[model samples]
Target: MSHPVDIHVGRKLKQARTLRRMSQTDVARHLKLSFQQIQKYEIGSNRIAASRLYDLSRILDVPTAYFFEGLGDAPEVGARDHGLDIVSAVASIKDEQVKSRIVTFIEDVSGRTVAKSA
Candidate 1:
């Protein structure tokens, strides 16, 4: 049986995708899946496989744990915060090339800093 968590994950996925102004077809193409599969996932009609979920997390620019963040929340607790954080961060990254350079720069700096401190 599919866990209720699947629905939560699906909702988060849908929210993130919509906020990014991306289509189900865009995500499906990136994940090498059919748009129908993406649709099923977004609506929680199907459970996402672990591997696919991980891929979705990356494509959505969220932590893998993002889907599980509000699983135990009260109705008052919102899942929109982290999803919005991702959307806002992504939107501010207006240049794809600059984004790539920034990621590479951060990775390199962090790697060297950690290595030197070790």
Candidate 2:
């Protein structure tokens, strides 16, 4: 029935993956699943088990709690919001530092930094 928490987590997963500039195939390879499964997970069509989610957190270099942040007041999340491919936008950068700086610049420009939320 697509629980809201599951949807939120999936959206967060997609965001984190994009921030890391990973493809669905990349994450799927780590999780030992098909890329289609990654797509399902990202869209909340399937729930990620705790252990698998933990493994994904490790692979994605994010804390386990990260996927749960900003949940209570979060807006509706899914691929339907303009179907934007955020990963491709960041994937062109080969330099990690450059990518990090770009992400920071985006956060600053969007005024959605952690301090603003706080």
Q: Mind giving the per-residue lDDT tens digits that candidate 1 earns over 1-118? A: 5568888888888766755457789899999889999999977889998999899888877788877887887665553556456544754687978755654575597573211100
Residue 90's C-alpha lDDT in candidate 2?
Answer: 66
Would you give me the overall lDDT of model 1? 0.72
**Candidate 1 weakest lDDT stretch, 10 residues:** 109-118
Candidate 1 versus the native: TM-score? 0.61
* Every candidate's lDDT: 0.72, 0.78
TM-score of each: 0.61, 0.67
How many backbone clashes are present in model 1?
Answer: 0
Each prediction's total of clashing residue pairs, residues at least 3 apart in sequence or on different chains, is 0, 0
- Model 2 TM-score is 0.67
**Per-residue alpha-carbon lDDT of candidate 2 for residues 1-118, written as tens digits (9 for 90 to 100):** 8998888889888887776667889889888899999998888989999999999989887899988887776456652433235555665778979977877887888786422100
